[model samples]
Target: MAYTDDEILAGLAEIINEETGLETDAVQLDKTFTDDLDIDSLSMMTIAVTAEEKFGVKIPDEEVKNLVTVNDAVTYIKNAQS
Candidate 1:
């Protein structure tokens, strides 16, 4: 089954928070993962892993690099789930 935007957002928050040791409530929709949340490559990779496992989806490498913001990850998750 596909996830809703809210569900995607929730999953992203959980994954990102867990990977970066940040609070989900601290993330903003427009915040850049790198600049704002301080999520590095390794952490992002972990986020990807978590997202893939949680949603049962594959995110392409090219698309992954382009994702800089929380919304970007949520959008990717939503599309992947669909």
Candidate 2:
């Protein structure tokens, strides 16, 4: 079954929160992963890997650059699943 956007967002939230040690409530769609969440390049890659596994989608290295916010990741996974 395909996952809903909310489910994808929640999954990304968990990954971001775990990787960055940030509160889940602080993770919002509009928030910038780097500026708002303080996610470094290395940590970003880690989140990407975890997201790929959790969402069952492959996030290419080049595409990783485009995922700058929580919304971006959630959208990508939702679309990829479809």
Candidate 3:
């Protein structure tokens, strides 16, 4: 089954928490994935890996680099699902 936006967000949240040692509640959609969430380039690669493994989708590095916030990832997943 295709995942919902909430599911995508949750997946990203789990990845963030795992890589950054932060809880899901600490992540906000508007928060910058790097500056606000303290995610570095390497951590984002890890997040992309998690997303690919968990969702069975390969996230392009170009696409990943465009992600500035949790909402960016959410939108990408939703669009990919479409």
Winning model by TM-score: 2
Q: Over the stretch 22-70, how does candidate 2's per-residue lDDT look in tens digits?
A: 9888889999988998899889999999988887888998999898888
How close is every model to the real structure, measured as TM-score?
A: 0.90, 0.93, 0.90
lDDT, candidate 3, 37-78, per-residue tens: 888999899888888788877689888899898888888877
The number of residue pairs in model 3 that clash at the backbone is 0
- Model 2 alpha-carbon drift over 4 Å, by segment: none
lDDT of 1: 0.83
TM-score of the candidate numbered 3? 0.90
Sort the predicted structures by TM-score, highest score first.
2, 3, 1
- lDDT score for residue 81 of model 3: 65
Question: What C-alpha lDDT does candidate 2 achieve relative to the native structure?
Answer: 0.87
Clashing pairs in 2: none
- Estimate the Cα RMSD of every predicted model relative to the unseen true structure: 1.2, 0.9, 1.2
For residues 1-82, what per-residue lDDT tens digits would candidate 1 score against the true structure? 8898888888788877777778988776899988989888877887887788999899876777898998988887787765
Instruction: Estimate candidate 3's alpha-carbon lDDT, on a 0 to 1 scale.
Output: 0.84
* Candidate 3 ranges beyond 4 A from true positions: none
Candidate 1 residue runs with Cα over 4 Å from true position = none
Error of 2 at 78 (Å): 0.6
